[model samples]
Target: MKLRPLLITASRWKQIQQPLYPWVVTVDRIMRHERLGNMPGPLVHLFSDYGGAHKESLYETTAVLYMDVDNSMPWQVERLRVRQHFLPDGRRMSFKGLNDVKKQQALIPFLQASDSIPGVLLVAAVHKSIKNLCWSKDVRPDWPSDRAMRHKWSPRTFERALHVSHLAGLMVGGLSNPGQEVFWFSDEDELFANPTASNDVGNLFTMFTSVYANHPFKQIGLGTTAIDEGDRYEEDHVALADLAAGSAADMLTELAKYAGHIPTKVAIEFPGEFSRKTEIITSWLGYSGGNLKKVMVVLEPQGKTGFSVMRLNW
Candidate 1:
C-alpha cells in the first residue's frame, strides 16, 4: 500500500539537526538516502519495527499508560543518540542513507520544524540507552489481568506491570525522539513541537509554575496537545482523534483556573479515541498513596485496550 508520500523541501533537507519522526512512522525507513551516511554520535541500534511476539506488540500502548500515572518522575532529558555515520564527537546529526531525493525530501521540513522548538540539543551521552525499554508479558493489554480483573485487586502488581512497560517504551521513545520537541496535534488546527532548548523548557516550566503557583499541579515536561492538521502519529497521543478537542493551550487555560487547589493530576486530556485507558493506575514499587490503586493493561490482537480498577487500603 502506498502512503500519501510526504516529503520535505530541498533546502530544509540540507540542514536537519535531528532526524524527524516521519521516517520512523513510515512503514519502512531503510532507504538509500545519503543523509544517513554520515551520522556521528555514540551509536545505539534503534528498534524501529516490532517483532511477532505477544509482548512486542503491547510495548507502546502499555508504556504510554505507565507514564501517565501521577507519581512517576517525568525526566526531561536531551533526546539524541549516536548512529553509525558521523564523527565520534559529532554534535550535529550526521546521516548517510537519507541521501536519496525522496528521503531528503522527507527530512528537510522536519528540520525546519525543528527550528521552532529550542528544547533539543546535541549530547555526549544519556543516562539510559535504547536497549533498556521493552516491558511486555503474556497478559492481555486491552483488558484487565486475570488475577485482579475484578474489584479485589493488587495495586503492587499493577504498578510493577506499568514500570516494566514504561521502561520498555522509554527505550523506543528516546530513540525516535527528534529531541524535546514533542510534535503535538491540536483539535483547533495547531501542530506543536515542544521547544528543545533548556531555556524553552525552563520558560514553559516557569510559565506553568507561575500560573499554577497555587495549584498542586506540578508542571511536567513542556506539555502539548493536538491540532486538526493530522495525518500520522508521532508520539504522545498516537491516535488521530485523540489529537483533537484538547491542546496544550486548552490544558494551560483550564489549569490556570485551579491554581488554588492541590494539583493531584495535571489534566493533559485530548479529544477522540484517546488512549483507551484515559488514565493509568499503577503501584509497581509495591506502594501507593492510600487512594492509590492498581492498573491493569490488557492488549488485544491489533492493539485494542481495556482498563481495570484496584483499591489498596495501605
Candidate 2:
C-alpha cells in the first residue's frame, strides 16, 4: 500500500506549577525524532497547558500547524487558553492566556469540527468538553485531514487508547498492517465513569514500568541531562539499557488473564492527596533502573524539569 498523508496535533498537558521534569524532556526528545518522511506529508501540532514560552517555540508551533494547509483554504483557529488566534491561510495568529476557561471553552467547536477534516490528528490535554464531545452530523472522518490523523494516532494495544485510535482509522479508511497499530485512547463503550480500585492504580504504574524495562525497544529519542528547560536536542544520546531483571507486562497480563476478562480500569494511580495524577504516575513508572524517568508532557516533573524519578522504557 502507498504511504499515507497524516497531520498530527499533540499538546503537552500540565496541571502543575513546577517545571516539567523528565516527561517533557521525553516528549521533546521524541518529537525531535519525529522524522516520518515515508508518508506523503507529515505535520505536527503541539501545545502546552503551561505557557509564557518564547516566541521561537510558539512560532515553531504555528509553522507545524500551517504545513501542507492549502494557502487559499479558509483555515482559522482561535485558542483561548493560549490566548491565540490562527489563520494559517492568512498567516495570522495571536495568543491570550495561560489558563482561561473562556478561551479553552471556545476550542470545543474547533475540536468537534476536527473529525470532519481528512487525516487530521488531535492530541491535547484531556478536556471534559473534548472528552464528552460529540461531532456534528455533517462531519465525518473520511476527509483528508481526518484521514491523516487516523494514520498516526492508532493504538498499540487492546486498551482504550487503541479504541480511539482505531475508531479514527476506520473513520478515515486508514489502515496499517492490521498489527501495526492497535492503540486506541478508548471507546465510548469503555467510557463509563472510571472505577478506581485503591491499589489498582499503583499496581498499574508498577506493571508498565516493568514492561518498559523488559521491552526490547528503546526510546526513539535521546534522553538529556537535568535542567530547567532541558537542552533542546542535546549532543549525546544513549540507546536505552536493559531493565533490572523482569518485565512488567508479563506479570500484569497474567494477573488479568487469571481473571478471565479485560480490565475496564487499569490505571497507574497516585497518592490520595493530589488531584492531578500525571506526575504521580510518571514517578511510579520510574522504578526502572534510570534515576530520572521520561514520560510525555502530560505528566508533571514535580518541580524538577530534567530530573524525574522514573526511568524511560521502550
Candidate 1 residue lDDT tens string, 158-204: 33333322222232232222222221112111112233322332332
Off by over 4 Å in 2: 1-67, 71-106, 115-314
lDDT of 2 by residue, 87-143 (tens): 222211112221344533433333332222222221211111111111322223432
lDDT of each: 0.22, 0.22
- Cα TM-score per model: 0.18, 0.21
How many collisions per candidate? Answer: 61, 41
The clash number for model 1 is 61
TM-score of 2: 0.21
With candidate 2 superimposed using the best TM-score fit, by how many Å does residue 164's alpha carbon deviate from the native? 29
lDDT of 2 at 184: 17
- lDDT of model number 1: 0.22
